[model samples]
Target: MNLELGKILFTAAIADAVSNSKDFSAFVCQSIEKHKTCNWGDCDPEDSHQNDLSFESGGRILSVYKNPAAHEDSEPKIWIITEWDRSITTVLYPSDY
Candidate 1:
């Protein structure tokens, strides 16, 4: 899939985190690439299916990526979402939701 992500945005907290860590910056970049390619990161079957459906419906596209463990494993850090109109894509921690 060749999805075009419009202007990408992120929360201020995300900005701060990305700015402070090269590893996190790389993770964010790689996650975005996967999102645009329809990889959908670590989203479950239903969500991945929704992302696929979103292409035709122009509905919101959501991708969740597991962040490396700070305390516990399997924490979702990248809650990347592209709006229905594709006018904007946002990246943020799930806690920010």
Candidate 2:
């Protein structure tokens, strides 16, 4: 099911990147669509479980999306988090968290 994203937010660094880079901005937009539609990107099994539960349990939801060009062992490219109350959703780089 497609979920509500509530108020969307971005950290300064992410906002800057999006504003400055068209490719990255498109990726972020697509990632957000995936997130709201429950695709959950590259999140682990545990996070997948939590995301599923959050749909019914009113828990926080987390989605991790990776940059295919980045090293597999590197930190995630982005993290999208929707608050438990669904009052807000944020898109940020992991380091920005």
Candidate 3:
């Protein structure tokens, strides 16, 4: 994605990780509009919330493979083992991946 959308995604991730109230979470709703495939795994509907955790980041599809230990945890901690197609600008925010 473009720089603005990347920033918005970063902001939304921070919001998702921290916010407690519904009002606070609403900001991310608009921010992620550019990302057509914005998936939050357990946080969204359809009950296919577990197992595969994937989403769009910086215009590319991002997915995480869960280990047995990761699945056992309450909150799934993510680490970017590798990427598909990435832009140079996206590297600045390593924490996002």
Indicate which candidate wins on TM-score: 2
- Candidate number achieving the greatest lDDT relative to the actual structure: 2
Superposition error at 47 for model 1 (Å): 0.9
Please give, for residues 1-97, the per-residue lDDT of candidate 3 as tens digits. Answer: 2222232223345445436545323433432332223332222343223212322232333323222232242234332222333331111112554
lDDT of 3: 0.30
lDDT of each: 0.85, 0.88, 0.30
Considering TM-score, which of the candidate structures 1 and 3 is the better prediction for this target?
1
RMSD of every prediction: 2.1, 2.4, 13.5
Model 1: runs farther than 4 Å from truth?
Answer: 69-76
The residue-by-residue lDDT of candidate 1 on 1-97, one tens digit each, is: 7677899998987898889778888889999999999889888999899899997788999999876744354234778999999999999888788
- The superposed Cα distance between candidate 1 and the true structure at residue 46, in angstroms, equals 0.7
Model 2 agreement with the true structure over 1-97: per-residue lDDT tens digits: 8888899999998898789777778889999999999999999999899899998889899999986544455444899999999989999988987
